[model samples]
Target: MYHVHLPKLEQMGLIEPSGNWYDIRRGPRFDEIEPLLRVIDDHRKKLPGDVL
Candidate 1:
């Protein structure tokens, strides 16, 4: 995840990484996906059991 997922998410502006490996924060574009996240959270029980 450090080499692949994190970098990809950073590139997408979805997350901001601090200097420390375990420290991270929301990126500028987090708002762009917040609605989708809210929708998913609202319907999480209806999703496939393993989806989350």
Candidate 2:
């Protein structure tokens, strides 16, 4: 589920924990998740640079 995936991302510091919100963590770029991110990028055409 989406909820389960988020905590895993947080644990990896790919995303940070805000006040009950998930703010993306610093550095470590989405290229780290190229296979997955690429699939997503293909669907969306673009991903917000602010997050990746």
Candidate 3:
């Protein structure tokens, strides 16, 4: 399921791929404590500056 959305998200500007790395676009909405904070949010966060 998740593997299927990767390309779509990339094309939508939500994610950018570079070799084995990916960068996510950040914005005010990205920090919302609700949509992303909810356990039911459906996905986990992958910050650009996070240590892999």
Query: What lDDT does each candidate get?
Result: 0.90, 0.63, 0.50
Worst 10 residues of 2 by lDDT: 22-31
Q: Best lDDT goes to which candidate? A: 1
For candidate 2, the lDDT comes to 0.63
Alpha carbon lDDT of residue 9, candidate 1? 87
Error of 1 at 46 (Å): 0.3
lDDT of 1 by residue, 1-52 (tens): 4477888889999999998648999999999999999999999999988898
Worst 10 residues of 3 by lDDT: 24-33
TM-score: the better of candidates 2 and 3? 2
| All-Cα superposition RMSD per candidate | 1.5, 7.5, 9.7
Give the TM-score comparing model 1 with the true structure, all chains together.
Answer: 0.85
lDDT of 2 at 18: 61
Q: Rank the candidate models, highest lDDT first.
A: 1, 2, 3
Tens digit of per-residue lDDT, candidate 3, span 1-52: 2466766656555555556345545333334445545654444355344433
TM-score leaderboard ranking: 1, 2, 3
**Winner by TM-score between candidate 2 and candidate 1:** 1
- Estimate, for each residue in 1-52, the C-alpha lDDT of model 2 and write its tens digit: 2588777777775766666655544435545777886688676646566554
